[model samples]
Target chain A: MPPPLITARSLVKRFGDLVAVDGIDVDVQPGEAFGFLGPNGAGKTSTMRMIGCVSPVSSGRLEIFGLDPAHEGRAIRSRIGVVPQLDQLDQELTVMENLVIYARYFDIPRAVAQSRAVELLDFVQLADRADDKVDPLSGGQKRRVSIARSLISEPELLLLDEPTTGLDPQARHLLWDRLHQLKERGATLVLTTHYMDEAEQLCDRLVVMDGGRIVAEGSPRALITEYATREVLEMRFGRGRNEERVDDVLGVGERVEVLPDRLLVYVADGESALAELHARSVIPESALVRRSSLEDVFLRLTGRTLVD
Target chain B: MITTRILPSALLDVRSPQRLLERNAMVYRRSWMVIFSGFFEPLFYLLSIRIGLSALVGDIEVGGKLIPYDEFVAPGLMAAAAMNGAVLESTMNVFHKWRQAKLYDSILATPMSAGDIAIGEIGFAVIRGLMYSTAFIFTMLALGMVKSAWIVMSVVACALIGFAFASIGMAWTTYMRSWADFEYVPAVTLPLFLFSATFYPLSSYGSWSWVVQLSPLYHGVVLVRASNLGEWSPSLVVHAGVLVGLSVVGMAVTASRIKTLLLK
Candidate 1:
């Protein structure tokens, strides 16, 4: 088999006395949609910056396309596209001018750059705003323009940090569709997000990160199954009684997590678990039976929610 | 094992800075009023200082040569104009892009390195400085400020002066934390403008002439004046050397400083 498109062994990044990425290891094969799932300040952006060659790795072995990033940053960066956490578009220039000027950094010929800019603008559905300055564009349009700018170099690997953090649902769906098309064309993707649904929808394989460490690594389904039961029964009997009644359904499932607002019974069959709860005369204000998700797995590993 | 080689690419890639210059050109194309408005500052100074102040103070001597008050200060104004344009472009414009716009973050993602940004920004500053100098020089020629063919070479001098200060300005700006720190720019350059043997001869200061000798603007004024007067001296080499040396040292420091700050 050919080597993985990216490889990192004991990669470390430090900012002064703080260790942002503390000796983690990861590998990504070509054409795979890989993800880093973490909450804020979980070292996801730090890791992405090292991979992007914009931030220096304090110590570690990192190779992109078999080229050492520390030594050949320019060469490595030429093959990779980075959509930073923020939209860093030039507010003073027109949307098309942003892409064209970015292409100039790679020494793309003017005519070729213009044609590619036109095509990319069409791809992002911003062809009509090509002549307009970026400051007046809507948030979604600005993000699409940023994505278009990233693709101007036709990079082999695309790195997106929180690509859909603040987008409306419609905008996010459109971005997902555009990214899905890119993946279908065999472009390798690496992304980081706190959105579990986004990870489940996009990543083929991923690692769950917390506090500068990888707590779990697997496919979404594998992680959900391994870290949690096949289903979860959510029972809320008002705040005070929810905790008191937890012991009544103790043996109905493999494990139970008592949250402040509800009780979660982990079981292979949530329907049967709910029946058992009713037979025991434990009536709640509301009850829900649903399949397990990555959110459950994250809660199991970190003992906290992803967003808060 | 991994070893890093700093700036593995060629030192001072001309193409990158050229592209940066092109980007600025496109941006300014839409805002031609800003460029047109820059022309009036030096002319205003020439008319106000030369016509108004000269009528009261009379002709002055510089470098042991007596010349008309307007003639004496025209080249000095050109040099000051070059310094102003270069400093403003490099410091304020570059700082705004780096801090507020975060434009460099996007540019750095490409194959361009920190050095490319430094060179590119300086190149843009030099282009603007030359434009302002050209306008000032043409006005000087119209007002009978040109005494010889050597005035043609003063444009080159203006460019050099711009290059020197632009490099230094870019380097200095990296050390600035915010817009509040920019007050030092006018504080420093204004004094260089008013007291650098620009308005009068070194003899005006008498024993304190040593102060003018220490100012970079003094060398700039002498060089531009000599060219305008069709005089050449070996001392011109010293003046030109200072600007060139400043540019080289400033560029070197700026490239590495940007790398340290951004690539960390």
Candidate 2:
């Protein structure tokens, strides 16, 4: 529907000899919450920048809202909002001034900019701190200001590069709530994050990227089902003793993933896997049974945890 | 060859540079002290010349004409003042915003291009320079230093000088990789201010007068001094052309540098 809001084919971005974004294809439909999930230096930010029309594509074809980024960046950028990884809030201006001036960049008249700014600050829960400079605000409040500033343009699409990288749990939940409201209001969101929980909570469909390439792409549940078992049994042994019973723990489930401090057994039923482990006479210091998640899918696909 | 098209259309873009200028003005409004701080340096140099330096040399001769030492030194300081105002904005302020604060990164996230940022910044610095030049020339008038009606042209000359320096200063700043790189700002501008025929006539440089002409500030000093004393010659056009050419080159360099650095 709507012919996909964005489409990229063999998209490549290179900085001299270093290829940050290798050839990758992507499609994002309108009204969809799509994610680029990966660890650091996965070229997720590069892809977001190219889509935001701020960074030109080094090679390959990219179209946003049916316009080529290389020649029609201003046109494409006008209808999209971008929240950069770092809080780029204007330290010199008050929080309110930051939003108002950002509106002016999209050519919104002053009165309209002011009205929208007031409403947006209220939405981001920063209405009380409107007059204060950004330097004195908490990291969360500064981030909220950045979000409000991005929304001032009333953009059709929003690009968030690590929307919640360095926030406390409560602040992240608050941001998540605001983003949920935006989704309910029919805003198309494209975000990049290393947090599997953030991706699970926000993105409807996502691609797992590693070393500048997409390893997997699907809905959270679909990816876990395809790449992981229904439940995972994690048993931790003495720090350096996990390797001693590694062979005995094999074949207890569909497969096993060994972490530095623990062993993860993928199984349809965790209690049965525990019974089998007990039958093997290998007692663990601690054992946990939890449902499989995107983290599991990431581990299955990339052989590395999402956050690392 | 990255061609920076500083086109009329870009200037006319409704959303552009004016918004950038407005942001700068808003920042300055809250901290009037920063503006006044840059304001006082040129005046101190002028007044010190009036009270101290002028006492040592009563009058100086230039271009087959003799003028008060204060008159000769006033325009040089005025030009330097304008240059200082523009350079401060384009260099250190830009350095902070680009390096420390990362403000330009935020602006680039919007529809505003690097060219818009550069032009907006240079425009504001030129405006700041004009304000300083206006105040300085009027102060010269009050001190009875105005010798001719041509003094009105000094403001235009200062604006040109400021634009040239602002553009070049911004280009130079993009190459600064660390805080220590900024030491070159004062090291270069300080000596250039003193040696650009500001306190002494270019002929004082003797055989080195040709080298003096090569300095961008030398052309600015010549233009300001000639305008202040009502001295007219075809060389005024040459000086103005030099500034204009430098402005263009600087703008191009700054545009390309910002594109490579940020948009990478």
Candidate 3:
């Protein structure tokens, strides 16, 4: 196997007294799509900042493309593209000018930058709006312009922090498609997201983080297989019902979890568990059988729900 | 002393700094109206106060020569315009880019350092300030208000004044938390611009002349006035030295603050 394109060894970052990023280790290979899956304040963005070479590591070692971030920050930065959580496009410039000016930041020739800016605008489907001012573009269009600006340098490694947090579903899918195309062109991509579907769809491998520490790491499917049952039977309890204990209703399942508003019975076969519940005369307000997924694994590993 | 050698090669990298300055020029190009708005404020002061008010105040004696009141105030107006243009860009524009637009955050991700950013911004501000000062000087010459070609020296004085203010403005911007903090800048600057012997000579105030001498703008006005009258003296060298000293001290403070803020 090839060496990892990015590596972090016992990385730690502290903002004042609060440890924003604990001692976390990660390795991401070239041409691979890696992801940090976590909720807000889970240190996902902070970790991405460190690898992007924008924020210095408070402790431990970080290497990007086999170079130390502290000693070779400029050399490393020149070769990497970063899409920060907040869009930082020059509001005063036109959409195309934004891309062109960003190219200048990397010292790219003006003629080359202009040509590349047009190509990127076309790639993001913003060619018609190229000359339009940035203030008039919709949020989705602005994000697309930002993404295109990042690619102006033709960076070898790309770091995206929560790429589609506040976008509409259609816009999110559009951005995901663009990112997927970038990955197909052999760009090493590292992204952070709280959406399980986004992670499952884009990431080849991912790490789950909670409270600044990695709780688990694996492929989405493998994580589910390792940490969760084959199926999850969600049984919602009615209002104020002093219902029967979960042990009486879900005794046949391998494991049962009694939450405040629902009971989850984990088993190899969800159908049998539902039948057993019916046989025990414990009628739930609602019942559903669903295939196990990363959401289930995250819930099981961290808690009952994802906190933002 | 933080020697300049270890400050980071990124600051000395001319490519990115040139790009950033060009970017600011492009913004000015698109918003020429906004840029001219700053230029017009001083012109209005010159026309309304210097030209119009001159009829009431009559001619004034300066450097043992009888000079029109408007001629004496024209150089002061030019000097003040340079100071205002540089301060506006270095303070409000810099603060907006740093806080509201997050423009610096994106630039910092590139091969640009905070020091490069500071220098580029000050360079652009000085360029604009000189443009305005040159125009004002020509206007004074056209009106038969300039007694000698030495008035061109006022343009150079304007550029130095711009550099000093821009550097200090950048240093002050680092301490600003919000737009409300900017109220103090004009509150302090307006009083200095009005009472710093811009409209009248420092000697006119008698003993109170010492108060006007304390202002940086007073030094700028004195230098421009002396140069306008072709009356260069050793004291003018001292005035230039003071401007240069302020610029160096301000830039040093600004560079250190930028490293602390951006590198953190």
lDDT of 1 by residue, B167-237 (tens): 99998999999999999999999999899888887778899999888888788888888889888889899
* Model 1 chain A: ten consecutive residues of lowest lDDT: A299-308
Model 3, which residues run further than 4 Å from truth? A239-245, A304-308, B5-15, B49-52, B55-61
lDDT of 3 by residue, B1-264 (tens): 355564443344334557768899878787676765577778888888654688899888887777888887888888988888888888999899888888888988887766678788877777777777887887777777787778888888998899888888888998999999999999988988898899888879898988888788888888889888889888888778888778767776776676678766
Evaluate residue A246 in candidate 2 and report its C-alpha lDDT on the 0 to 100 scale.
Answer: 76
Ranking by DockQ: 1, 2, 3
- Candidate with better DockQ, 1 vs 2: 1
What's model 3's overall lDDT?
Answer: 0.84
TM-score-superior candidate, 2 or 3: 2
In order, the candidates keep a fraction of the true contacts of: 0.89, 0.75, 0.69
DockQ-based class of model 2: medium
Give residue B184's lDDT in candidate 1 (0 to 100): 96
User: For all the models shown, what interface RMSD does each have?
Assistant: 0.9, 0.9, 1.2
A1-308, model 2: which lDDT tens digit per residue? 57889999999998889898999899999999999999999999999999988778988899999899888888988899989898988888999999999988888899999999999999999899999989999878888888899999999999999999899999999999999999999999999999999999999999999989999999988998999999999999979887666788888888888788998888999989999889889789999999998988888888753221
| Highest DockQ against the true fold, candidate | 1
True contacts kept of 2: 0.75
The best-first sequence of candidates by lDDT reads 2, 1, 3
Per-prediction DockQ: 0.82, 0.76, 0.71
